[model samples]
Target: MPPTVGERAPDFESLLCTGETFRSTRLDEALDGGCVLVFSAFSFSAIAENWWKRYERAGWADFDVPVLGVTRDGPYAQNAFLRYLESPFRLFSDVDGRVGEAYDLLVEREGMANTTTSWRAVFVLDADRTVTYAWVADDWISPVPREEVEEAVAQL
Candidate 1:
């Protein structure tokens, strides 16, 4: 099950495009004075990146907190995806979905052959690493309502 609203978040370490390492344990260190939004992708969904860019341009990055883009792909693939979408947020590789699994956000095929794609999900975490908001998109084309995230962060 996912962490409850007031529960401590699970910590995870993953590689990022910045050549730096990250994990939920370091969330507070990264956000110190700001909030964070973890955007998880199903695969190569550029739409998600587009939505985040809107927030980035709207001054979300000005908060100085890290907005992490998490995926199951490695840093090499993530680099390509970010470059193609002109994404500003750093991408973190979940590789085998351990992080997703810990958060109860892992979505894998039941009987399909060798499928590894994860379901699209988003989680907003405060500097304390507690999950403040969560959403799972129903489809690849579904957009993450900007105000929903903004309003969540505004609360922090």
Candidate 2:
């Protein structure tokens, strides 16, 4: 299950990509002195791509804190989406789904054999690694609303 409000957010290490830069990043370090929105999505979904594309086009959601995206896709796919969408946030590759498993956000889809992908989810956490807001998808779409995320960070 995702960490509930007021619970300590799970710490994870993964490959993060920002613009053309890639690095091994830790969740706790991203949360230092600010907050991070752990955004999970399927790499190939039109809805996911379009929505994130809009966010990128608008150049919004650039709050004081950082919003990091996570997915089971590797750096190549992650960076491809980043390049295509021009997103303001960096994306971290949870290639083995370790981060997804930590948050219980993995979804096994049919026809994928034994492979699984991350369901859409959002977690806003503070510098101390405490979750301030959490939203897990009920279906293939409907990730957390952007307004809610902005409001969450505005209060921070």
Best by lDDT: 2
Q: In every candidate, how many clashes are there? A: 0, 0
Model 2: residues with Cα > 4 Å off, grouped in runs: 57-59
lDDT of 2 by residue, 53-154 (tens): 765554445667777888888888888777777667788898998998888778888788888877777777888878888888788765457777777777
Per-model TM against the reference: 0.75, 0.89
Best by TM-score: 2
Q: In candidate 2, what residue range of length 10 has the lowest lDDT sum?
A: 54-63
Output the TM-score of candidate 2: 0.89
